[model samples]
Target: MKCLSMLAAALAVAGSVQAAEVQVAVAANFTAPMRKIAPMFEADTGHKAVLSFGSTGKFYTQIVNGAPFGVLLAADDATPARLEREGLGGSRFTYAVGRLVLWSRQAELVDAHGAVLKAGKFERLAVADPKLAPYGAAAYETLTKLGLLDTLRPKLVQGENIGQAYQFAATGNAQLGFVALSQVQADGKLKEGSAWIVPLSMHTPIRQDAILLAKAKDNKAAAAFMQYLRIDKVRAVMRAYGYEH
Candidate 1:
């Protein structure tokens, strides 16, 4: 029965080669890129990444309270650092530097220099809630730097997060909005309408970071996905979405 024994051993080896699924919590600003990359990761490694998107701040709260996420891709570096300090995460690194942009679905609405802020041409200008979204904080900083915060306060409509802020602008609920450049860019160019890329000097850098949660420290699938993020092909996908490594 040597052949039967060998067949049993081969089946055991095949079972050992099968990959596991990992759960990930992603920042709202990164949803698009992650959506594109997750399947690629699964195809390459035989591992599955189940992703959930939302504000990093909310994710932080959930993680602290024992959410089952194995990894976190935050919109800003601070949240990931905090998780590490709190002993909830390990092996953190800056994955991308995010850029903020002033976008309008309508053509000729937002000028290249973003001077429309001073002209008061729009009835409602949307921004993500500064308390929840890092991009929202950057938007607030940009407005303050441009001396428009006080003047534009009355005209502001705040979204729950950057994704929602983008929706407000896209659906014409708000005339224009401050959103992540990735939301408006595709294939290394603006997909539609008018946009003013905010100068990085106007606000603090949005250094997005990723971390392996302590809960998944020993998880092979979680570790594989984290390594996949650093691969050149994945970085290229991130670049197409306007992220800088």
Candidate 2:
């Protein structure tokens, strides 16, 4: 009992001494899971995660322009690799594998087989800008695989990122939109809308990667946060939001 007490005291002192804040730029698709994770991370490690969520492409640009981000959780693996090659990033690894979905506000608007897309019943079909979001690229690839890109091109509406695309569908600005599965799913079920979870064969895998930025090389909090992401608790949260880790 006395040895256990001494070990507990030592751990408490170490945590207090190492506690610090990490600035993380997270992809928009990871918002829900990250929100839940940030608090848990702080509680567990005595380090605070200051998160900013947005499109991975935009965040990459920002990082290049000297954005004060200590870490990046990108929506695609390529961005981190680019940063690594440019010497702007340190350690990197795949944190999650994302899934795409065609979602609608109406519960029955999207069929399980995703045949509604061919029905042409909707006037507007929203998608993120493929140049700025990986999910958008996946959506386009899916459309192409189904031989529907040219047919649906006329009705396409673009958003700056997946979050905006989801908003467009959620607010009825677009009848339906291509979004991250994590955005509309929790507890292994859809939240409020109808969706067709796009098959993996339709596009390249969306391997989301996390990187320790060059500016954060000496930041212990940043390194700890990156390591924390691999814990079982964090993986559970990612799974709950439909992310494969």
Candidate 3:
């Protein structure tokens, strides 16, 4: 029947569409903005995104072990560069740069005018585990550059990743922590907290990059996501969430 033939053709097209989903391993720092951008991507391209968020280091380790991710959004370029060098990723591109902040759950604890370090009022501090999270490396560099590393080191609790570092402060387990700016964006506003945006000059640039994995080299959906990252609307959304293009 003609009607049956038309229905069969429609079903075939649907199957092809379903097969185009891209699985993305995203750094935890980018999770918030990625969430906001993925729907726009889907709307524009008719492809779905499957995302997993964790420390970039951990994600790199997993990818090396065959984690089946089609793309990687890393907090630093080194991971993507490594993937490219290893033939695991076909191409590399800078997506956005991350900004670090000193954040505390308590208003009086962090010092609005940025005198907390000078006052040394807090007995506990938290940072991401430097071995795991890129933000931790930036935090260490910042403190070291300020000549505060030795003094602050004694008061530190290390979280496994930036998310965990934020948790440490949110749960009051640590008085303060270093976190990504994206984590604080809620309802188009920064979260209620006392925060000092760490000067970028204090540390190495957090040059985040995204890559299309080898397994996804031929995947249209995966490539589409990369192009989506460069779109002006997506950049606008990323900027609103404190990402630097």
Candidate 4:
């Protein structure tokens, strides 16, 4: 009888040490990379990552309202900084730096140097909502720097987020769009579209930041996943998705 009792206690302790599942709120631009990384993280640490992808602005509002998120991978550093300032997040760090690109599914529509923007050949151009997405704001900045914002205003079609903006161009709703470099690139090459990699000097850096939410301060799984992101193998996956860590 004592042996059985001891076995029971051991089983309970082992169960208590089992890994946990973490809820991660991710920016849309990082969706692809996170999808690839989540499985690897789980395999390496026995922790499952549950991901939710959307605009950083929207995720901020949700987190402020207690969305039960363990961590946030934001599209911009400012959002994470704001969360830290509000005491909603703890221990923030930069995870990746994003690059913007002007892309089109149609062949020969977008030029290598982005001269196509000056020509104004398209009837409509897609861009994310500048107020809600950092990539959109960067797109605006790029157009303004090129003296094309005013010229292109009439033809602009605003998407709620960069993903939708890319969709607009992909599905033929708009001829071209400003999107994340990862969206159109695979294995260090263009996937199937023409793209003009935007110059870094044209706009401010899109330095993406990650933070552990206050709600997850005591969650071991959350801490493990955050640490996983900093590992060299995980960073390689991020780079494969066109992010600079």
Q: Summarize candidate 1's per-residue lDDT along 91-131 as a digit string, tens digits.
A: 99998999999999999999999989999989999999999
lDDT for predicted candidate 1 compared with the true structure = 0.90
lDDT, model 1, position 51 = 93
* Candidate with more favorable, higher lDDT: 1 or 4: 1
lDDT of 4 at 4: 41
Candidate 2 C-alpha lDDT tens digits along 191-239: 9979999999999999999999999998878987887787766788999
Compute each candidate's TM-score over C-alphas.
0.93, 0.94, 0.89, 0.92
Runs in model 4 lying further than 4 Å from the true structure: 1-17
Better of 2 and 4 by TM-score: 2
Pairs that clash in candidate 1: none
Question: By TM-score, how accurate is candidate 2?
Answer: 0.94
Alpha-carbon local distance difference test for all models: 0.90, 0.91, 0.83, 0.89
The residue pairs in collision within model 2 are: none
Clashing pairs in 4: none
Question: Candidate 1, which segments miss by more than 4 Å at Cα?
Answer: 1-16
The 10-residue segment of model 4 with minimum total lDDT is 7-16
Could you tally the backbone clashes for each prediction? 0, 0, 0, 0
Candidate 2 backbone overlaps, count: 0
- Model 1, residue 54: distance off in Å is 0.5
